[model samples]
Target chain A: MKKLINRQPGRVGQWALGLLPFVLLIIAYLIASDARLAANANDKLLPALNSFADAIQRMAFEPSKRSGDYLLWVDTLASLQRLAMGVGISALMALAVGIANGTIPYIRATLSPLVTGLSLVPPMAMLPVLFIIFGLGELAKVMLIIIGITPFLIRDLQQRALEIPREQIIKMQTLGANSWQIITRLVWPQLMPRLIGAVRLSLGPAWLFLIAAEAIAATEGLGYRIFLVRRYLAMDVILPYVVWITLLAFAIDFMLSRYSRWRYPWFHQQGH
Target chain B: MAIIEMKNLWKEYGDQVVLERLNARVEEGEFVTVVGASGCGKTTFLKLLLGTEQPSRGEMLLDGAPLPAEPDESRGIVFQRYSVLSHLTALQNVMLGGELQNSRWLGHCVGKTRKALQKEARAMLDSVGLGQAMDKYPHELSGGMQQRLALAQALIKKPRILLLDEPFGALDPGIRADMHQLVLSLWKSQKLTVFMITHDINEGFYLGTRLWVFDKPRLDPQAPGAYGARITYDLPVGNCEKNTLTRINRSVGNTSRAINDTL
Candidate 1:
């Protein structure tokens, strides 16, 4: 007999084990929803499953009467666009600043302390300031996400670059590599996979900052739509939106990890 | 001519002395193997030869001139680990030194230049017995194979001096024997001046034309770093009688054995 710590399920059993919690949660939700509907029939807090289906159909399939656009797709597109812009700019900045800070002593001395200080700042606290300056436009929302995650990404990449073995650097130097060659040929390629990993970790916080910004002031976005329906206690609409956002986040993370594995097989080998 | 000459070289870091009063003259095509107890500055000596560390208090002349402050293509180094880049295939790793030298900005060459470099790199890999594994990444290759790739990478530059800091220390006994043969052949054919550091006295004697032993003659109990290691014995290989081996082994004592046991 195996000890509890040593025991692990086989493939079939593992699949069943993984699904058990989700199945239990679904059953619990169904039962809770049935009881709430039986008692009040007008409970918005725990809407019946059919109400959620109806909300999804309305938000995703039907065009709005006033706007004549499918609300869900429009909201998703707007949110994704802002998220892409903020994160893209952050990635480029982190790569340059992080590699410079990691590889060059002068740049590291000049910028490392500043980056550390910026990371220590609470990005949420800057939201009001950002809004006042950038005027509640898309820039403010994007800036919040950038301000929230770029410092962290830069620090992560800097540490990753520093973690490159000292021997490798010496070996390259002995091979007649100049400073620029070492950075472009060695450090840059090495940090790309790490950058992807860092971005994956930052995605959760990036989403949080993005949603917060949108919730405060936006015409249409997942967060804005969710907050707008809160006065009506529209749990069906809110729940569906929340689930959709989560699915999107999961899909993005999955794809990024897959891409990293595909592109940098060597990095994944070290992980294993 | 003496390709490298160290006149009373010393290396110290802050209050701590690492090596002191070291003097040696290594000629071209000479294989010098260094053996010492841990913290005896064998690696520091190798770094000095590789041009990564400048002598703190003495002069190191290369080819009748002062050694460069930084490492360059005239010398190449291979460590026990991280000698090969993980991102590059075995072929690309060999070509990297050449590619960087040819192209100033991009560190890559294209078309005819690329083809010529590729052919040269393939030949270098073949010389190191990694011809079939040219496409493999460093992680995919075995430890011995990876070291072979590392050797190929260093040799591609046609460096006059090769500094190996226990390049085969991590390998198994069988693999180490194979590497020894490969290295001896490379040294003879390339006419390279080799400086290798090893813990095994037998390896030092077997592989080197000249064997250097570093030890500290003075020590203070209160301050461990008070005295630094010096080249206590510089013996020519093939002429060191049995008694000399016993004397060195006895003096090196449990420290060398401890290092070997851990390995």
Candidate 2:
């Protein structure tokens, strides 16, 4: 049974993420009770979020004196922007499409050349063509990001899926699995790490690519902010976002890698 | 109901022939092992059975029907290394093929109705003496444990025919015996037909009810499969003595005896 808490090491983070909302709700109720006592009254339902927002603000603004904190905040805020767009929406789309390609041989074979061809081209080179079609908006940026990363996922995930032995698939077949079921049960579970890795690797580059993506936009975003600051020769602000990006990308890639290792420890055993 | 028949089976890779006009029948729920030297075509034969390769020349019939061109969920394979999904824990990997073959919403909705799948997975793990390591990933366990998990995963789908490609080739001596014992037990319990390929003569003799050996004359430039290309032998299963290996050594160890005499 899927217990409230998984009893396995290397899986706590994943289960916790799966169970995050309930944890947050419990914490919220506890805090609500404390505030009710402090105010000496029954708190109204639909309680305000000022406390949470205030906590975030404090964390963001608190350790400005420390350069490291400043750097962390800058990167976090930058990723927050891209995550809202790229990782949030386009990633899901790419996963849906990329995983499809990985699961089915026909799709992979048909789209491989085009996908690989697109992946090899610099993201900058494809910007103008994307702009021409989507017309200078979020659609173009997201599309470019998706196009840029989808191929990497297609290629990576296909090989990873293939790495799943032909016998495993055969075994499943003898047990009586249909194609769709096989994909969900056998293919997706195996490709989870590679897909997650592809998404993580795609993230920072998506942000960097978004810089060129947002060239048409009027304002907002660290990428745009960088271009604006660069104009005024405000290297300090620009430098922070760049450094933030590097660190954020590093951290995300690291977590993604560790998660992959944790999720599928079997792959390492054959060699070791 | 679960009989495997090969009719004039010809498997060739390019011009090389692994099996030339070979015919064999694997009876229902029979435990058959294919044994050969390093260069023999036993691996190729197993691959053909698993539908990993085309007959290049013939077809395989499963239970009176032609074997599907592609692998089916009903057909579970546990290879020496490929059986276990590298990322999932032992229980999860064991449950994976079953869930895929049985459930529709895996990794999305409930991902196999945790209770039912877990129950089955736990049962499978327990049968393999891996109840303690159900939650542990493959790498965290010893080689024997991983092989057990692999076997459990192959058995996950309750397959009528289990195809194993030297699944115990990587295990140490003791574990290899344990694995062989586990297979014999599972085979009897589940009434499954097993087809395994191994280079280990002891393993071939011990676990398998029938031994199919594919031998070829050392590379004849003119003959096909000089590069280990030929379907040379397929023998029926045999009985074992308390120390059958020692007895076989006394009989077949004459070559060594001859060398000793010369020395």
**TM-scores for candidates 1 onward, in order:** 0.97, 0.71
Q: How far off is residue A172 in model 2, in Å?
A: 3.1
Q: Write the per-residue lDDT of candidate 2 for residues A1-272, one digit (tens) a residue.
A: 77868665457787878799988986987687667656864343323345444534543466646354643356356435654566556556556666667678798778767777867888678878988988866677666666666567667766777667765666556656678777776777666766776777677667667666665552345566566656756443555456556776687778877877776555434452
Off by over 4 Å in 2: A1-83, A120-122, A126-150, A213-217, A229-232, A235-272, B73-75, B105-117, B217-263
Q: Residue B166 error for model 1, in Å? A: 0.5
Provide the overall lDDT of each model, using Cα atoms, as 2-decimal numbers. 0.91, 0.67
User: What CA RMSD would you report for each candidate?
Assistant: 2.1, 13.4
Worst 10 residues of 1 chain B by lDDT: B254-263
- TM-score of chain B for predicted candidate 2: 0.83
**Candidate 1 structure quality by residue, lDDT tens digits, B38-99:** 87789888877777788889989999799988888899888999999999989899999889
Best by lDDT, which number? 1
lDDT of 1 at A87: 91
Q: Candidate 2 chain A, which ten residues in sequence have the lowest lDDT sum?
A: A41-50
